[model samples]
Target: NAVDLGAVLEQFSLVFCRLKFIFGPMALHALDLVDLRSVLHITSPCGRSTYQVTGSSGKTYTCYKSCHYCSCPAFIFSVLRKNDSMLCKHILAVYLSQAMGACQELSVSDQQMCDILLAKDG
Candidate 1:
């Protein structure tokens, strides 16, 4: 019996497209899951405002507070799905935003901010 090559090709294409939609972001998200220690709190204009939320397995995450702004691939996906989910970056942003009031001294250094966060964590 002769196989319908054209029909098989069309079905394959459909399957591939669907898979791309499902797997593309997941693959990227896996990449996004990095070590918390890797997320160095570089001094940013936002003011020493960054930290990593590491999972038990050491997968670090950063959440976006806004739709167009996210530190991680998962944030973008959550934003697209219209879910207000908390990620490591988002929590850090919140902590820093609040910290700004407490650490308003002009002389405060970046290290001080880290100290503040560590203190609060304890």
Candidate 2:
């Protein structure tokens, strides 16, 4: 994966610095997801990777590492529309997963990935 942890952490701190204290609780939740190993790193045979996380609600959310996106309502309402924060807790979990090497890697076919991504509900 060649991801430099230091660089990723630096970027996280830099981006999150702009957010307010309201998002503080999400950090703990993100760390919990990482510690619990709820993050999944699914890769296809072609070397493309996709990120997904299981929330406390027992639903899986698709997270995009390439564009820093998550298919979570908090991300859409708070992070994007309201601009309450730069990233969702799930996205934070993704970053923490990368930095801590806490993700469960899975190999799936392109068709499986498509089915997973196109799913309306997890």
Candidate 3:
């Protein structure tokens, strides 16, 4: 099950199958993040949505599902600059969480959501 990630395993099997079939190794990495409950789906009062995923290093990165963009350095360096990957693990995690309904959802005020968007990750 680990190799090729073929044959659905336990828990979120459908999402795992889809990710493995559609993405590559990073999809597997995303599953690890998902298992950690790293993905958070936030909805503002006005219905605007945002996502955040914690990386292995314990840093949370913002993810934009609409653009398949992430604030993680991996996304900037590998996906945008080096053109070595399609999406970062954080972005992949978000996708996996959404597909599996595994995300930890939060409801926040529009102002809070705006602050999250503008706030520096550091």
Each model's lDDT: 0.42, 0.83, 0.83
The better candidate by lDDT, 1 or 2, is: 2
Candidate 2, 55-90: lDDT as tens digits: 989889999768878888888899889987889989
The digit string of per-residue lDDT tens for model 3 on 5-93 reads: 55545445876677788787888899899999999998897988889888899988888657887888888899999997888998878
CA RMSD of all predictions: 16.2, 6.6, 5.0
Pairs that collide, model 3: none
Q: What's the TM-score of each model vs. the native? A: 0.25, 0.78, 0.80
lDDT of 1 by residue, 12-122 (tens): 688546634655533233223332223333244445554444433455443222323444455556654656543334343334334333212233466665554452322
**Selected candidate, larger lDDT, 1 vs 3:** 3
The alpha-carbon lDDT assigned to residue 7 of candidate 1 equals: 83
How are the candidates ranked when ordered by TM-score, highest leading? 3, 2, 1
Compared with the true structure, the alpha-carbon lDDT of candidate 1 equals 0.42
Q: Once superposed on the true structure, which residue ranges of model 3 sit more than 4 Å away at CA?
A: 1-22
Which portions of model 1 show Cα errors greater than 4 Å? 1-40, 44-50, 62-68, 83-122
